[model samples]
Target chain A: MSADTPPRVPVLCFGASGLRFAVPVAAVAALDAAAPAAVSLAALLGLEPHAAATRTVTVTGGDRARALVVDAPLLLRVLDVGDVVPAPVALPRNPAVLGFARIDDELVQLLDTERLLAAS
Target chain B: MTDLRELVEAAGGERPAPTAAGAATTPCVGLRTGGRWFALEAATIGEVVALPPITRVPAAGSHVLGVAMLRSRLVPIVDLDRMLTGIATPRSERGRVAIVRAAALELGVVATETRGLLELPVADGAGAGDGTDDGAAGPEGASGASGASGGEREGVPWIAREVQHAAILYAVIDAPALVRAALGVAR
Candidate 1:
């Protein structure tokens, strides 16, 4: 609300490998049925692979693009910058992680579209 | 039934004093993880709390279990067992999270059990022998007597040194080094 504070932005939240994650709506180009080129978000995160991904989300960052496969029932929410917390320093350096946001009593890992694509 | 404090006080007075870098009697919180005994300097520890809901991060190393919000701050929870031994600790086996701070970095380390605060004597040098002066025994004694060297263990840079108390050897974890390693900061 302050003059210096950044405004809230819309984000798309989804689940993969039983973990919740979010990314800026601007980065999400399209949401479609599972495609052959879609990559498992769980596999990308080194978690146990989930075979139940029913949707593929096409994300774009700069000139690159990647399809992230995730579970259904996605939630769209507006994220306040103040609610975001920096990732703990003890975690391994991950370019994909922007930080963590507290949304409705749940902690969601925020992702950077460019970094996620690069990681993919 | 000798008290650990009495043993530490007696040991501090009897043993050769450590160098300036090492304290004569260092207060540490004893922890058991990966079936191995370890200690974190009391000054570096903030609090011990039950494991909170953790949100796993993408592309994080295997040692990093996830990040959890503790006291409004996101603290990365490192699985001590997985970090020290290449084995994942069962969720049921995790007992507590010891919130530790090193420099400006703060994180939580999972421990199978915490053995409370202990005043342990640091050896004179980096390669000094174990502090087994009186061969005294107690309740929490003899749980882990791997016969490893007294001071620093080989190949474990994060371990500042090894100290013995009540017949148990505890690897004193170097908080700064651990924080650096956890953040992937170069030494």
Candidate 2:
């Protein structure tokens, strides 16, 4: 790939409060393997927390670790680099979301792993 | 489903002849504002969406209604009716928002109705003022429903150009100039 083009990264696609969201696969240490320990994606994104949310995506960076509670895990897929579109300048400055990418005709907001984990 | 290879082969590769000189046409997105027809260059439009809730700002320009979150971006909503007709538009479910992009600024303009795309001759050659003189009177006179003459520009501005297409007169908006004026920035 050219230096300017972004590298294709693995992400765990999931839904939260009816809206689609994705997190980098690298940040996830485990999924649905442990009890509730991390923060909730809906809470961080200001969405209604669904009672049906059962999956936990455990995120770890260096010595820090946090779990993100979300709806049942859907798929772990490598996103097509071309489908990603950078966030517009008008969007509020929030580190939790980096940009958006299309997955199955749905525009899923890609979560910034580090920032999202820090929110807990 | 059509086979990709067959679809590509069936399409003959031939460049269509360009229109004759003086017959060139420019595509425009037609819209209705304050009960009158208006046109904007198709290239300047980003998308047409429902007018979302606007968060009003204090001490902002008169033309700037407020800003609204559009596709995760907070875009300024310019009240075209208020800007052109010197009257606040009544809130209604029929209102449409036209996302206009120029320079680095992307904003929305609340329109009464979106009339879809239109193709107009590059040059009408029918002289400047055609049909009812509403080109100078803004939307009020064009609609012929009210006498809001005070809102009309006494002098011709660079942003609004009077143009005629298919015997119908329209105020063709200059997107870039309009953006610059809305932001109060000299270019």
Candidate 3:
């Protein structure tokens, strides 16, 4: 915990482009896996706010609530919540955009949903 | 080959006879554009409302038409036609909003039209034509082809019917694709 680090929030691990971690509540979009694709997706057991790789990003929900789904697994090194900085522009580093996923003991690309949406 | 109706008749003796495919087709709201039918599994749909006011999400992509609020859900409505055909088409006469259910969160789409819920016949006629529109409807064909199978035949243009009066065109959307795209899970 440092003077500059931002606070940590609960996050879910999504394995996609690379190992990436994000808060489940902040990631809004997803895959319509089933047919008749409309789903009433219930809330997932949200991330454990304070653990390794916990990061938070504020977004303009505007009138909606969303969950963040990253494309990768979280890193081993824990991020000090105090050092986090939520910038209106793209995230410089700290929060991962390039990472890997732990799929059956293998690492895959996990996407950064927060940045993806923000970038768009 | 065993017909689908026979299989369903065997499983749930009381359920409607299955079509050609063995498993009972899930009740889906089929959105047909161009020549194919894209079914959004009914389970994923939250509320199907007529397209109200869609406020533009500045700098949003082509797939994203705009945003609309449904029952306080404040959903981000996507444009299925543009997302699929890759060619921009006129919005349906009865444009609609489809609130979708995902694994962790909910999303809404601005469907050109909301075809009433459908119980598709199993046989999505293999080797059937994709019912495409003009030269504009390219690129998406090869990419979205392998996935468009299993949609029951309805019409050439109105293949993916959103509703009876939807006057729709194009194929059914695989909800996962939309979700993945939103989450940046898929490229």
Q: What's the TM-score of each model vs. the native?
A: 0.81, 0.50, 0.40
Candidate 2, residues A5-38: lDDT per residue as tens digits?
7788888998777667788888888888675456
Location of the lowest summed lDDT over 10 successive residues in candidate 1 chain A: A86-95
The whole-model lDDT of each prediction reads 0.72, 0.63, 0.41
Lowest-sum lDDT 10-residue window in model 3 chain B: B132-141
Which regions of candidate 3 deviate over 4 angstroms?
A: A1-120, B1-17, B20-23, B32-37, B121-170
Ranking by lDDT: 1, 2, 3
lDDT of 1 by residue, B6-103 (tens): 44455552343443435565567787765577888666777888778777776667777778887788888887667666686555544888887776
TM-score preference between candidates 1 and 2, better one: 1
Q: Model 1: per-residue lDDT, tens digit, A43-71?
A: 77777766565678888987898888887
TM-score of 1: 0.81
Each candidate's DockQ:
0.55, 0.05, 0.02
Question: Which is the better candidate, 1 or 3, if ranked by TM-score?
Answer: 1
Q: Which ten residues in a row have the lowest lDDT in candidate 2 chain A?
A: A85-94
